[model samples]
Target: MHRPAPTHAKHCCSLPSPCKECFLVSFARGGSWRPPPCPLAMGNTKWADAGQASAIAGRRRERLIPRSGPPVRSECLDGKRGETGSPHQLEGKTMKAVMYTNRRADRILQFTSDFPDVDWAVVWSPEEFENGVADADLVVLSNRICTPELGAALARGRTDRLRWVHFSSAGIERGVNMGLPRDIPVTTSARAKAPVCAEHAMMLLLASSRRIWEIRENQQRHYWARNELNFTMRSIEGQTLVLVGLGGIGAEVARKAKSFDMRVVAVTRGAAPTPDVDDTVPRRRMCEAFADADAVIVATASDPSSFRLIGSDAFAAMKETAYFINIARGEIVGESALISALRAGQIAGAALDVAEDEPLDPKSPLWDMENVIITPHVSAAGSTNDYFRLRALFAENLNRFRAGRPLDNLYHFDDGRALPATN
Candidate 1:
């Protein structure tokens, strides 16, 4: 049967929608629960029946939609089904949501603590659909709420009345992992990661150029290589750096690359000039960039379309003398292709903050390579309020959401995935 479009989406992305990602961390999910009535749902013309008043529906659990796919960008790979198929963005309103929780009661409280104005419900023990869970304007999926059932419940809970979603961590891949509906306006806390990742990129660049890891390895072998021929340090000044996928992290990477006087060229789907970019090229021209740059950095976020965005052919195009760095997600680069690139010297060397796999196995050959430098995902690690700094930005956005102001950090909704390029 045909249904109407979401009334709230029309207002969702105006201005800079920066504060929406933290809503994910605050959702309190229950097995088979009903979603809260969205404040914006009132404006929607797709009513279950006229005179069926939301007040009556609020007394009983009304199923507005079904939870059938991934949490964010969970649009069917084939095609969206039902009335919820097309993308609907929520803007100019604070979406009310029930934050889910379980054993991590403290975390649940802390997650929603910042959003004091939100009328939130508490669930000590989850039921197979708390029926009342969906009574709010939106739902917050806290760290405690992770389950196939909860994912399903969330899908059902999303409604036109609900206008916002927030992800606790920088990645909504977890929501993707659980199969969320791509219909929702899902945003990740990735904006919060840019500055830290920028710092990480700098560290990796400096480490590779100065041969820090190599020096440490040589010292571990009870030898010195600082004065060795291959160990000679190179200054970052006057070097050419090409950055791929100039999103938040890439833009930040460019800002930092300037400290060393490196020339920066960026290739991205946006095809628009960024603040710190010297040249803004398209993705197809990336290989040409590789050939011209002395170092290349990949800082785009992860998604199915972005998987292995850089691979053998691109690597083959790089200058045999160029260095490569990845401060972005690992899947952006194909695994075997990268390994071969180093083994064959398609590129001079590489440094990575992320990998195709976590805890890169001890058996992995990349660890043995002399020119490669690797670190567990510590590129974003900073002491003190680093994490809260990210969350705080999101919370501030939430306040903006409630006030009906424009939002920042709005995700570009393509046919399905969230691309950096805005529609």
Candidate 2:
């Protein structure tokens, strides 16, 4: 279910600590419940309650530290700054950041108090957004709302003051294609969604192997079909699993698949071996890898090069008993060819979290296909933690930007694609 974007702008200055009424209201909205900050710590306007505030502040500060180490990119800094990891440089300077998001303004506004030196403007309506973009020193936005017009506005509004542009979501291909300025540094919250998405991929993998849909049908009919299921159900243990990409989500999936004792084969553009992958096959030799797999998963970034990358030829290379699972973009697969492959028994079954067309046509043949399980792009759902993780990443980057340090998950545009950050 999609909520309509808010029609007004909310500045952080007037925002208050979450109240009991706010909790009740959020709970009434069904699945929107997020534990508000401790009232004792945030109730006072100055947030002077040391005990609770100190504990929470410690956690927020920990999030700013990189898991590996601080990222370093000389090109991202100005020569005058001398690339030192210190907070003293930005002491008196006040920066302005304009953010466009679907999340409620009040919810996001609550965090702005931590960055008192930075002005925060959370805009949802188009009119407010255009004005906000023109004056912002930093911009944080969602790609879903970044249309061509908004992208052009961002390009025209770019000033020397604008240091960085951040996408709240991992995928920025759409925003890049929409004419985002090439000069500004762009970053994304790429790894934030990895854990949950990888879990979804594993869920689909398990469901496919055990023929979970058939088991559910038996349950619906009140039939004890243990004898029938034992003969048909397959175990994933010791089977070969092919991964098409080794980005954040793909790498996480590889780690999880290893726990199930599955042999992992990775098909990637790079020659380097991935962490848990048993074999590394070049992208051009993906068909060869497909032939040796019991199941194949697509987790590549969607770009012009990957559009319809998986089609009849790739499907023909797979074993008749192999399952196909795609937790990536649907445009990466040839829909008609996939349907034909399933009809011809080229593959046993498929589990998809995305489709070539979103809100897939109810009349589409894929919906009626017994060999296919379709989820409405909900692989990243059911997690409030992702929201906080993204907020933490944004806050950490803001701190980096203020300190003239290299940002995490920076997006490169050399190949006309939003390449994921190496760090």
Candidate 3:
């Protein structure tokens, strides 16, 4: 009494657009049959048969954004999709993505080349993002633009179609504070700017070690400072350099440090012995690592646990002639303790590319200190290569998303909140 489903050959329909929806075709003996009016024409997206089996078993598509749960630091969330979740529904439809960046349009245009099928909306502010984000299936932006208000709006379902978020920065901690949804996957451009960041750290170390700033000042004054310069100028050949973090940047710093023939001792959370480092000190023994160091560099990722990780005790344990370099986040080093150390000669000097607050306060004593060197956090600049690399990464992730494959650079949160990037 039940009739079997019939398959029609060369099916045709009078729908307005080519939609990825199932069709019921009744075929006669000769394979000539009428294609039923597509139910998709009525705007009902619930598919019946063909779309059900599209989700692959191993491809987990859980949200990477955090939910409105009790204030929990967002962890790397990954889970398999349910039986009904199918990317096939998005195949024929114009997959729209909203990209927020202060970067140029040509770079964004390359994304269009990679995904010709997708419609991208370029925005620069949260207001712009909110305007067109309602229809977006994906959001690509810098970590700085991901404000808490924007995140809250997304969590409240302001954009039901959003599937993923990509940050154009290596620092995932900034994005973590945005309270992104737990179900949406968030990715960063990890390792993209490592080479440049490492170069900057080395530059700071070398400048501070050889008293380059002092030499330059003496030259400007037309004063012969050979005697004074020789007094403070130290040779890096046999000195011990302590690197606080062993992430991409820190690893590069280690490599460059070895080229100078300096002994490298890394302080990290159980980092494996890297090629350039001669010794390893666990984070538990950070103060111990600083004891005899000629220079200590902080390149760790910024997180709750990392805030003020280096303070009075760590500075007090260092040799009086030791130099402190921070190319990482500013808050990682205790500002007050560092100021005290610099004033009291607890350490020789300090080089900071980042500070407790950006554009350091005018009244701060660090500005006038002869031993301190401060640069406006521009360590990641001077490289167009990083931009191209990020473009390629974004394209790859886009393709992977469409193909139902897992993404790369999955930033997993740990109990420490600030997990070492080496992991």
Candidates' lDDT values, in order? 0.60, 0.69, 0.67
> Would you estimate the TM-scores of all the predictions?
0.68, 0.76, 0.73
Estimate, for each residue in 172-211, the C-alpha lDDT of model 2 and write its tens digit. Answer: 7778878876687898777667768999999999999999
Query: Which parts of model 2 are misplaced by more than 4 Å?
Result: 1-93, 105-114, 416-423
Task: List the lowest-lDDT window of 10 residues for candidate 3.
Answer: 23-32
Q: Give the TM-score of candidate 3.
A: 0.73
What lDDT tens digits, residue by residue, belong to model 3 across residues 1-423?
A: 112222233222442221212211111000112334322232212223432332112342221111111111111113221111123346456677887776675354455443444577877656777787787778776665567866765565446677788777778666678776557766767666776898999999999999988988999999999989888898889999999988767877998899999999999876567888999988889999999799999988888878899999999999998999998898898899999999999999999999998789999999999889999899988864565446535544555566566665555555322222221
Comparing 1 with 2 on lDDT, the higher-scoring candidate is 2
Model 1, residue 352: distance off in Å is: 1.8
Top-lDDT candidate index: 2
Lowest summed-lDDT stretch of 10 residues in model 1? 23-32
lDDT-wise, the better of 1 and 3 is 3
Q: Candidate 3 overall Cα lDDT vs. reference?
A: 0.67
* RMSD, one per candidate, in order: 15.2, 11.3, 16.6
Off by over 4 Å in 3: 1-92, 102-117, 157-160, 415-423
What ranges in model 1 sit over 4 Å off? 1-96, 100-111, 121-133, 141-150, 156-161, 229-231, 415-423
